[model samples]
Target: MILGRDEANKALRAQHGQRGTQARRAAAASVIGTTIEWYDFFLYNTAAALIFPAVFFPESSSYAGAMQSFATYAVGFAARPVGAAIFGYWGDRIGRKTTLIITLLLMGIASGVIGVLPGTDSIGIVAPIMLVVLRLIQGIAVGGEWSGSVLLAMEWGDQRKRGLLASFAQMGVPMGLVLGTGGMTLLSALLPAESFTSWGWRIPFLASLVLVAVGLVIRLRILETPMFAAVVAERRTSSKPVTDAVKHHWREILLSAGLRFSEQMPFYLFTSFVLVYAVEERDLSKTFVLNAVLVAAAIELATIPLFSRLSDSIGRKRVYLSGAILVGALAFPYFAVLKDGSALAIFLIVIASMIPHAMQYGPQAALIGESFPTHLRYGGAGLGYQLASVFAGGPAPLLATWLLHSTGTPFSISAYIVFSAVVTVVCVIVLPDRSRADITDDNVYARTPGKHRTSS
Candidate 1:
């Protein structure tokens, strides 16, 4: 049974090639699963802005009801950090794929429940309470989904292509936004206003069930990431991954929270609050705002991948820094265009706003995932990113609405977005250039000689 040296070498090469194929398959599956998860999540946000206030909070004054509904929407974001801490521990200790499957199922069920739930007319006070509960569950599920999916992609990719592969998972954001908004727009057009207000809004939520099934099927076929396997084999899994992340990687966690604050805050402002702002403040039609977002999302689908590729060549920090700076400078100008209340003005603002957003978003997944080690990657990244939702994504729409109502000027809201961008610029400047780091080496936890310890 003894083999020649050439035959042994051939066998080793064949095994390595198979592993590469499996890794690519795993990465692709992760991307698609995250896309489905985000699609459901974004659909809820769109509904909150457009319909939930009328359906669930009918007892309050119109403006008060809108704010209250948005508060429920924020509840999901607030729940995200808590979800990250909980699911992240299991993901880092038990397995990434297992955690992702659970999250996907949880989110799907929560979204489907919302689609079928009776409104206040049928259930009275219990309706809003049930809505809030479902939103919390969705938030928690999504909190774990992003980190697990991104880590799966990053761990499976070649070190040089890590940024590109990880960013593929993030492509879900714009893809989901486009699909959710586009579907709503189409449905809105087909149905009479009364029908849409009565039952048409439920279609998008119900559609999530189909997407969730498809996502589960795709994810079930993929093997676990090689990095997580190595951690398991070495018996180096952290007993408390969340604790370890906080103890050693706290600064990275803080920076990550701040870095995302700018990107996510402005996103909710543009995509969610802007819809309400246009319809109520500018007297623009619902279809106009919906179509504008669809166009912007289409641009994001193309631009996100391009920026991700660009990050591979120029470095993530460089690309991210430029994006933060551009967004900070453009915040006021973007809102200024919206002031005109013309379709052309809305189009210009949407395109301008999303372009900078895409630049930062393109390389974002890899940049965040690269900040942590293999054993703690999912927990660390998830906690950091989800916690940012509290001040960033969760409160953004509410904050924008409050500012506009109080000041009667969009300039106050623009200032809030600009402030977040400034924080991101500072954080990006301090992050290490991971593009040149030896990411494939298993000794990721070992501090490089002369390099200060990085925050998680």
Candidate 2:
């Protein structure tokens, strides 16, 4: 039936409004899903630093036990790149939404299982073995989760605001850190010390089941990203996304991995290692360090998006470079301030550290996602991002501990931070600024007019 011009215009407006609503909902779901995933992931990190040494490892010197627990924590990161390859393939071949559901389910089950598993005393060699296995599953799950979540948010938004939009998913990291640390803080405060270490840490792991259920519901409601949809509609899905990424986009992947050094290294140093440093070296109470972490994470919830929005205005590279510089510049001061042993001083250091962290992290999702074409993005970005876990994030606390034990000072650790910062600055300088790229271009490198180019 023929319609009046005014009726047609009205219908068009209504359809546009619905699309806007869907886009916003998709962004929110992406954020919530990533937050839950990271909560499950970081929960394990917190437990490793504070509780696992005693509960999961055999009796040993305090330092030895702590080292063993951190070794297990590092195992999770060892699985991340493998997860990135496996999930990235499916995410690129099938669809982003479906891949996310599988990852979320994997993570939730792993975390809940860890909560129920027997400790070393109960099962001898079996307990720690099972714990490492579950940690591996958690690692794999999050390996897939980050790339898909960031793509889910970025692919649905206006390209002009992609930095700000993708940063929503990045916000989940701090949110998860808060939830994970806060849960431990609250549990530690409520229970006596002996009881807290015995079973309290498991509560947060079990609670993962509930949060996972909520994340699944939100994720299920969102539509697949338009970019992936376009690929499917054009029958252009990669048969082997992981292979294609490696074959064609290896340079981008390498640079992307290097770019993460500054961000990942400092994060673990600030969050996980500091917990041990404050408690052991400075003789601060566990609660004080935990509370300081909580406050810093809360501040990041605001700052991540703020810096991300800044990236939308200035450029992703400039904002990210500024953050790397701050990290290097503040490395020594960070330790010096914390060494004062005052709760207020540690609190200030924690907050100061996160400000530089959020600046880099806030724009990181967009920066990496934009590095490769849409078809190869899931695999390329995930591989690049997760690879950093092995050399950077996973080894951070262990490295810091070794540095302190050997040198007997934080100066060595400061040098480590500066080295990572230099690596990131070099990478950021080499990596192209694609904040303004036309994501609709399937051949991102070949035809796209950008600062840098690689064969794809």
Candidate 3:
């Protein structure tokens, strides 16, 4: 069924138009799915900061117990890479949609379980252990969730708008953070402290089950991404996707892990650990910190998409690099603002901090997804992202706590975030800008036949 060149061109254009529509749809799904996953994740983090120590690990000293609870919080991050490997393989081999759905369900069940689980007073030694177990499941589920959702959005989008679309997916983080914190804040305010501690926390976790169901329904309506479908139809699925990702894309993986180090570390520091730091170190009320976070997260929700769209006109690297540099410079100032303990100062600092965070976070998904090929894209991105959980996301809160306790100076924490930004700056300089690269065809596997090495 040969056609004229003009006819072929026309057909290609039509296909591209359809792909554009699909990309938009996929991006919407990615945003929704990621929001649900992070809502559950952030709710736990908020609880850990405000309530978990007393509720889950009741026997230790107040400070020791909080540290212990945070340690358990880190356990999920430790298990992330393992989950990434397991689900990432399935995402690449079977389908991104299927793997995403499975991850969402896993996270929903874990969150729901946490909502209903008996506390240490009721279950004694078994309660914290169960909490840790559920956290591990969450780590695994969410480890795979981000890569799948981002890849779906990136694969469907045009090269020019990839950053914008990808950022939309990433925007889910701030959105989820806002929702999670807002829900807790509302509950905390409405219920008396006694009732809030006793039962209000459970409402947010239970609410996740309903959100997950909504996410599942929206996701089920969308078709598998055209790019992944093409891979399946051509029988190009990697039999050893994880190994191939490691052997071929190891450098990208390392760079990505390092690139993520700055963002995730500072993020948890600012959002999760800051609540405890403010209350314990600065003597500010919990409500003040929560309100500050809510303001920051709200600003981020609006700024993330704006920056992502801006990256489409400018380049991804330029936007991301600027963010890295900005955060590096502002790390010290941000903590200094918190030191003042005034509500206005806290609000201003939060807004300022979130701006740079949003700038980097917005384009991050497309940038990372563009680093690998379609066949191993899921495994490659998932492994790179999840591996960072150990050094970056998982250890952030613990390290911040340790730094504060050890140094008694908040600047010590600033130095840690600055170091992460430094690592990211170097990684960004080394990696090529793939904004205009033809990701659909020109990739590591397409260029190298038997041996798989991704060309820069």
Candidate 4:
């Protein structure tokens, strides 16, 4: 099954019409699919912070309601690893295109169901339980979607621009942030407070159905990656790729999760938790914070690609570590700016903060994807990436909420951010660096110069 170089080229050439054009199409599909999926996902984050406690947990006091709501939000994060395992197996076995399509549908439908669900008044306890279940479905679908989108984009493009192509998949986070936050802001502004809470919130969730339809059409037209085709032609795929990834590449999986602690934890704090902190504590307008976060996300649309492109010349580890440090350094100052409560200062700092995040996130897809070969890449990358949701991104709002009330100080949350940065810096130093190695090696996993193979 180890084809000669010529045969490998033939297999790749045989699978598609034009390599350059298809690669672009694949990247486009990745952007659209990931954007739609994250739009659905971010809607939940925004709602959990701004809308859910009042709707689903109306019986509880403010603190208790917020905590309970975020706990449901965290349920989705807890389910991500399981999703990674299930979808990773199918994605690695059948193909990225089909697995991604399944994930898009699952996420879209879950969001739509949330849109129609009865509130606590209508359904009593069943309402919150149903919400949690749908959140889990959303989490699982997203857990699988991220790596597939990245691979669809990265594997189809020129190897030398892996960082840039990988960032195309990453573009969804900020773009979706803008769309979700913008949608929420627009509705809240347009409707009465009662009406907005009761029904206006559901519009964004319902919109996901239409977006998913468009994403499916784009994804269907794109072929599977040539790299994956080579894997199939070489007959190199495992029946249980997710299991093998955990069994053989546990180090990569764990370290990859660790590397995102700084990135993911702070992202939620900035985008989700800050909305609560600004409105409840600082007495800032909800619309103002939402608009500020919206602007920050738009800025990342530029910064994410720039930093990722820079990683092509430098290294993934370097860009990522620098981001971790910068984000950590900015943490204390970020809150300090909020404490000052100048509208201009808060907006300026909020917009400036996401650039550091882009530095880590832009290069993140390829950085993790390079840890495993094509046969195991989907499951391996997905498991590692999604595992962070449980410990990092998912718990961030809950943790920030707790820290705020317990310590009665904004700086307590900043300390938590710094801890995440420390973990990330230490983890990246220890994880393998394969940014320069050949990613398309089918016979054996590629190794860096002066290295033979990765140590178990």
Candidate 5:
């Protein structure tokens, strides 16, 4: 009897092993779903910087229109935290898979609607108002999307490769950037300027529908994460996860938000604001700036995964802090390089900027997700990450543009980047490295005596 039981247990373990095909499929689903969602979100950034000012917000001066359009873009970031709270609650209370599916559907519909929206020429003031509303919907959807993707991929793998698996989801950022920029680049090249500005810009937004269809099929088929399943089996799921996360994991929440400052600021500067700066300040062609962003995004596709895998070996903090420090050091050089007005020089600058951004972003999901216990992980990570969008990501382009316009130089933008980087380094120093922690439960609460940890 004892020999028969031992054999049955071994067979069961083999059947349910995480290293099997199911893990790979789950990881793929996380990446695919997020890639589609981000493709939709980022499509807006490209439009806000390039096409929206003329089409949606017609002001007395081009600069005013561009700044106004960017303000609308910031509205989306403002709404993100709201989305995080709503979806984060459900994601923690129910499951990651279900919440992710909802977010994907929401983003697809909003983006497709934007494609068909009439501009200021046709609809008067209503056009920009409608644009801001749809952008908010997109914001909420993306606000919910990131935490679920991170947790879904991270939970499917064991500790040994957790950072690497979590980064499979992070890869979606660059994938979306490539798709958004590549599509815009192609259409802008193929169409004449009038046609491209009038209708061609809508193609990328409309394309979100098709990607969402495929993402939905894949996401619907994947299983709920094993960590959440175990929580359910033990009846340890939190009823109000968002509230609990605020009360218990507030330090992690603040630290995660702070860590995002440098990462998020340089990202918008590199990808979004660079178009305006290069064209208006340096007299560079729009095509050249777009192509630069495309190449940098492509390089990130390789670098993000490489850095993430490195984190799995050395440590998350070392990789994250190094990236933060690099951003500060390069802040001044970034402006100096751009002033040369050469295409090759701008391309090199764009590509170089992504290296530090990816180094932090690659391992960022696991770093934040691991800080909280399993039940509150979704809510904690989502709130922290989305909150950063308000202070860091949303204001970055607007601030950069204002500084350039006010000071008549890029030095203000450089100072801004350095300040944000300092905040990130400080947060990195304070936040604990939980790379080896068992996140399967709140079990760590018992192990850390006198710590303010909580158990479900």
Candidate 6:
């Protein structure tokens, strides 16, 4: 049957509306999935700083116990690269939606188990060992989560607006920090100190089951990204995405990880190490330091997307380098203000500190993910991004704790932050800005420098 012109126009408009709705839903799913995953992940960081040292290592000295707790925390980061390799393969082979679902379930299950696991006083040496194992699982799950979530969000929409769309997934980090830290603060405040140490910390972990459920519902509703669909249709999917990425895109993989040093290293310093500094070194209340972190994270939620949108107009490198440079600039002052400032002054400093990190983190998703073609993006981006956990973030707190004790000043730690910033600056300069590149190009083996395209 032949349709009228008006009917054809109406159907076209309806189809466009449906596509927009699908894009929005995919983006929302990315944000919620990452938020839930990071919520469970960062909650362990909070526990390591406040509860695990005492609960799982009861026989050790205060400093030693803290060190052990942080070691286990680092173990989670160490597991992320493995998760990246495993999930990145499935993401390329099967699809983004399915891979993401498995990661969410893995994370939620690990967290819930940690909540019920017996502590050292009850289970002896096995407690800390088991904690390490569970933390490892959490790390691997999140390792896969970042690139998949960002790709899910970015691929569903216009590739030109990738900076903003990717930032939707990036927002999950700060939002997770806020939710995890804020929940801990409120519970610790309400419960008796002993009770909080005993059981309050477990509440968030157990609640992750519910949050993960919500995330699954959102994620399951979305279809695979259009770009991935094309990859499958063209028979471009790889059985060994990571192996190929390392063999072919090794330079980008290394540069991507180097680019993360300033962002990830100093981020751990500002959030996790700084918490240790406030409570252990400066004798600040856990609640006070936590509140400061919660506030900083809340502020980041607004600023992260703003900077990401700004990158769409300017460029990724300028916004990113500015943030890297500031990481060095603020390294020392961040400690000084926390040590000597009045309540209002310290609050301001804590809140002011993370804007630079946000500047990098917001644009980072698109900048890194843009480095490779659609088919290889999952493996290449995931490996490069998660590798930073091994060298930068995973050891930050442990190193900071040692520096504080041995050097008797925060300056040593400040110098370390500056060094990382310098390394990142070099990487940002070397890595091509693919902000304007055609990442949707399905040519996985293109020889052209930054952007990929099929030869006519």
State, as a TM-score between 0 and 1, how close model 6 is to the true structure: 0.94
Please provide the root mean square deviation of candidate 3 (C-alpha atoms, Å). 4.7
Tens digit of lDDT per residue, candidate 2, span 124-221?
A: 98989999999999999989888998898888777899999999889899899999999999999999999998888899999999999999898878
Tens digit of per-residue lDDT, candidate 4, span 229-345: 777665676776777788777888999999999999999989988888888878988899999999999999999999999899898999999999999999999999988759899
Cα deviation at 67, candidate 4, in Å, is 0.5
Query: Which residue pairs in candidate 6 have backbone atoms (N, alpha carbon, C) closer than 3 angstroms, thus clashing?
Result: none
Candidate 6: tens digits of C-alpha lDDT, residues 1-456: 111234334333433566688788889999999999999988999989999988999888998988998999999999999999988877776778889999999999999999999999898899888899999899989999999999988988877788999999998999889999888999999999999999989999899999999999999887777777766655556666677778778888899999999999888877887777788766888899899889999999999999999999899999999999998899889778877877677778888889999999999999999987777788889999999999999999999888888998888888999999999999999998989877876443354234322211
On a 0 to 100 scale, what is the lDDT of residue 424 in model 4?
96
Give the clashing pairs for model 4.
none
lDDT of 4: 0.88
Assess candidate 4 and give its TM-score to the true structure: 0.94
Give me the runs in candidate 1 sitting further than 4 Å from their true place: 1-15, 440-456
Task: Tell me how far the alpha carbon of residue 262 in candidate 4 is from the true structure, in angstroms, after superposition.
Answer: 0.4
RMSD in angstroms between candidate 4 and the native structure over all alpha carbons: 3.8
Residue 214 of model 3, lDDT score: 96
Q: Please write out the lDDT profile of model 5 over residues 1-456, one tens digit for every residue.
A: 011223323323433863466577788998998899888888899899889988987763788988898998999999898999999989876688788999999999999999999999898989989999999999999999999999887887666888889998899998998899889989988999999999999999999999999999998776677677666555566777898888888888899999999999889999999999888878888888888888888898899889888998998999999999999999999999898647788889888999999999998988898888877888899999999999999988998888988998898899999999999999989988877777764666332223322224
- Global fold similarity of model 3 (TM-score): 0.93
Give all TM-scores, in the order shown.
Answer: 0.93, 0.94, 0.93, 0.94, 0.94, 0.94
Better structure of 1 and 5 per TM-score: 5
lDDT per residue (tens digit) for residues 204-239 in model 1: 999999999998888887666667666565456677
| Lowest lDDT block of 10, candidate 5 | 1-10
Evaluate model 1: give its TM-score.
0.93
* True-structure RMSD, every candidate: 5.2, 5.4, 4.7, 3.8, 4.8, 5.3
Instruction: Please state the error at residue 148 of candidate 1 in Å.
Output: 0.8
Q: Can you give the lDDT of residue 82 in candidate 6?
A: 95
